[model samples]
Target: MTWWPEARDELARLWVEDTSRQQIAEAADEIDRVLAVDPEARGEPGPEGFRRLTIRPLTVQFAVEEPDRMVIVVTVRLLTD
Candidate 1:
């Protein structure tokens, strides 16, 4: 089944205005691709059915909805000190 992944509002904002805008966009693209195929196999399972995946300077939390074939990317944040 195909999956539709959506980044949350804050993450989308980061894509447009953050200094690491380019990288954030690229990471979101990759998240869509990876989650599309086999979401269950991609991220490490987290609490309450959420999963976490890290791509470079960002880490995203996502959940798969089997009935809707959707992947909701609930959180995306830059890894900063």
Candidate 2:
């Protein structure tokens, strides 16, 4: 799975710094939920056809390229800074 730099960094930080197995598991579940869906119906569409999916405490930004059969996760972030 590809992740934007921020998302990658955050996940890495969580794994190393947070150390809460439940929280990490929940986040993983959220990621799997997003990947399992037909995003067009699951998330709000954004500019250039990007989609945003909110999983409590975090928002996942992604884009789907139909022809290429790709779901590119653009970023992941908290609901608020």
Per-residue lDDT over 1-81 for candidate 2, one digit per residue giving the tens place of the 0 to 100 score: 356777777766665665464666586577756766676676787767778877665667777767754666787665443
Q: Which candidate has the top score in TM-score?
A: 1
Residues 1-81, candidate 1: write the lDDT tens digits. Answer: 222334467776776777887877787678788888888889898888889988866788888887876877877788774
State the weakest 10-residue window (summed lDDT) of model 2: 16-25
Q: Could you report the Cα RMSD, in angstroms, for every candidate shown? A: 3.2, 2.9
In candidate 1, position 60 carries an lDDT of 82
- Enumerate residue pairs that collide in model 1: none
* Pairs of colliding residues, candidate 2: none
TM-score computed on alpha carbons, candidate 1: 0.78
